[model samples]
Target: MLESLKVLDELRLNFSQSGLFILNLTLAFIMFGVALEIKFEHFKKVILNPVSTLVGVFSQFFLLPLITFLIAILLRHYITPTIALGMILVASCPGGNISNFMSSLARGNVALSVSLTAIATLSAIFMTPLNFSLWGGLFTEIYSRTDASGLVRPLEIDVGQMFQTVFILLGIPLVLGMWFNHRFPDLTKKIVVPIKRLSIVFFMGMVVMAFMNNFDYFKAHIKYIFLLVFIHNAVALTTGYSIASLFRRNATDRKTISIETGIQNSGLGLVLLFNPKIFPPDLAIGGMAFITAWWGIWHILSGLGIAGLWGRKRKRVVTIQ
Candidate 1:
């Protein structure tokens, strides 16, 4: 297992130029679909109740990365620096494209979910690059402390370039989608369901294409990476729920924050990993690549499971009451 994971440092997932382009377009459309669920009322509620929104954002952008840092430190000897950085990069990302839907499915605060998603997505433009650089840089420090060679590459994120990329991918599309939603509510209603379904399909197809491009590695190593991702994801969900609970937010709010924090935008991470300006294949950030790909698939399963249980539990509680 150790050898398999160590090999990831050298094995790069080859993402073709056309594949990268399709991935970017697919992710942007997903972000646009997420925006369709947003409205002024969502932000208005967040502004009024601010506590839940603040807690969710804090858990996502701040606490999630911090906890991931500590987890990396704890597992320093067990995992490669590249894999640890992959975990950090995912933690630094905003809530996933499906978080709002999960929130609603769980009988949580849909408004807070949308509000947090909007704010977190916008914030990720800056926070994602900053947090990844900041925390990922720390991994080098930890490794350098023990290794005389100090060959582990610290992830260097260019904030200026990232800002431009994020704005074009997430910010602009979001603003346009929100504007369209505002301008034509009926039209938004007509297409929102189909768009959301298609976005999900697009992403699933992206994952399949990436695997087809690197079938041998993905098939061989997926099992090795599963538990690491599960633990990391668990930390995120727990951190959000714990913080929200500490603040005495109700069950619905707790569920919203938990799901939001746990389900990160790994699609964005994959995008960066594939970008020539970023990690790219030759850099052999394979640990990052594998983790990102698996996380994308695993979190969907975990989120839907949790949402299903919560949805059922809520129904039971309502019946009892």
Candidate 2:
């Protein structure tokens, strides 16, 4: 099994940058398809149910990062700063598309999940960099003690570049996807499913490329990477559920929040990492890539279990009542 995996990793390494770019383009196209499924009215409903949406946004954008920052501080005492920063970077990301899919499977408020994911993704154009800079700055205070070579990159946090990227990659593609669905419903349906499957394959290819290029770096940072990702994901799940409970949200809202907070836009993370001036740890790049990839898969499985239990418990309560 190990040998087979090694062979696969090497093959991925042999894959060129052109292949990686193709994978990214596939991801963009898949996201465009998802956008087609989104109804503008779905986002509008948030205005009606202000509490749930507000709570979700708060947990996603604010509370999760706050909790992550605290945890990162504690972890810094014992671990390298690269790993700590990596956790922060992942936590700061918005809810991913998978969160919407998982929320639907969990019998949660799928509309609410979609709304939060949309809002969070849009907000991340600014929030991601700001939160990263804030946490990165804080880490700088403690980073001196921890020996992480090339931890500080020239991260200017260009709002213009970020906005442009979001418009092209997310906003514009999403609108186009929705338009296509509206105009050619049958074609949209046909393409959506295939594009979704392709997106997964494309994502896996990117991960393989990362492993191939930086296998040694990942090997060295494997422990820190795993530990950081585990803790970061745990904090995200806790923040989502805890905040929902604090606000006395319903079962459905709680489930939505949990998935939203836990799943992150790792694609955005990779785009940010690629900027040499911005997070310059080549090893950290591999670490974030591997950890996020594995974490994305694990979180979905864990979410399924949690959502199942929540649904079952809710049903039982209603039965007893």
Candidate 3:
């Protein structure tokens, strides 16, 4: 199994160009399946449940990034700016494309999952760059203030360019996915499941390959990366549930929001990391890639634990109430 994983990882790195294409295709196709299953009436119902929606949005769009920044700041004695920025980037990222699949598997509100993914993807075109700018900018200011001349410059980023890229890579695929559901329902249905399964495998391979390619560097960072990833993911899952419970949303909505907030599109992070203008080679993006990829596995276990615990608790309450 380990050997196979290594081979897959190598293929993933070699075929990343094609791997990315496959990933995009899979996201569009699965989301298209989700779109087809959505009902106008059900969608309206989700919208009407404004509390759940707002809490979810607040946690994802605002709270999580804030928490990540604070953690980075508190740990500034040990963590580097690159690691800090990496965590912020992942935090600022929107819901993972795989959330819909996991939501479906968990038997959560799949419709709401789809809608959140779609809206978040669209919103990310603006929010991602903006959030990063805010968090990264603040971090830069702080470091400069404290460290005197040794401080690194704030990320001089181009929000417009990023927005355009998101439009092409994320927004366009999303629009096309939704369109495919409408235009080619049968074909969409026939292939969506198979493609989703394949995408997961392909993506996993990409993660492994990324590690293999930079195993030495990744090994060095694994200690800190593990620490940050755990805290980052824990905050996400807890904040998601807290917001959900605060608003008294249904159990199903809680599950949806938790999964959506917890899973991030690490592939997007990888893309940004590789952009030379963003940073030099052997920069922090590799750490982000490795961390986020590992986080994905841990979160599956975490989400399942949350689900099972909820299921048992609800069963007992029902037996009494």
Q: Per-residue lDDT of 97-162 in model 2, one digit per residue for the tens?
A: 567777876778888998887678667767887787787667756665554443444234554555
Residue-level lDDT of model 1, residues 121-182, one tens digit each, is 88988898889878888777877787665644465555677767777888988898899999
- On lDDT, the leading prediction is 1
Question: Least lDDT summed over 10 consecutive residues: which range in candidate 3?
Answer: 1-10
lDDT of 3: 0.66
Per-residue lDDT value at 258 in model 1 = 99
Give per-residue CA lDDT, model 3, range 159-265, as digits (tens).
66666655666766666666767677798788777766765666566566556666765565566667678888888988887888888888888888888888777
Model 3 stretches astray by more than 4 angstroms: 1-46, 105-107, 277-286, 308-321
TM-score, one value per model:
0.96, 0.81, 0.81
Q: Global lDDT for candidate 2?
A: 0.67
Model 2 misplaced regions, further than 4 Å: 1-20, 145-163, 216-224, 277-287, 311-321
Question: How much is 269 displaced in model 2, in angstroms?
Answer: 0.6
Q: Estimate every model's Cα lDDT from 0 to 1.
A: 0.86, 0.67, 0.66
Distance (Å) between predicted and true CA of 44, model 2? 1.6
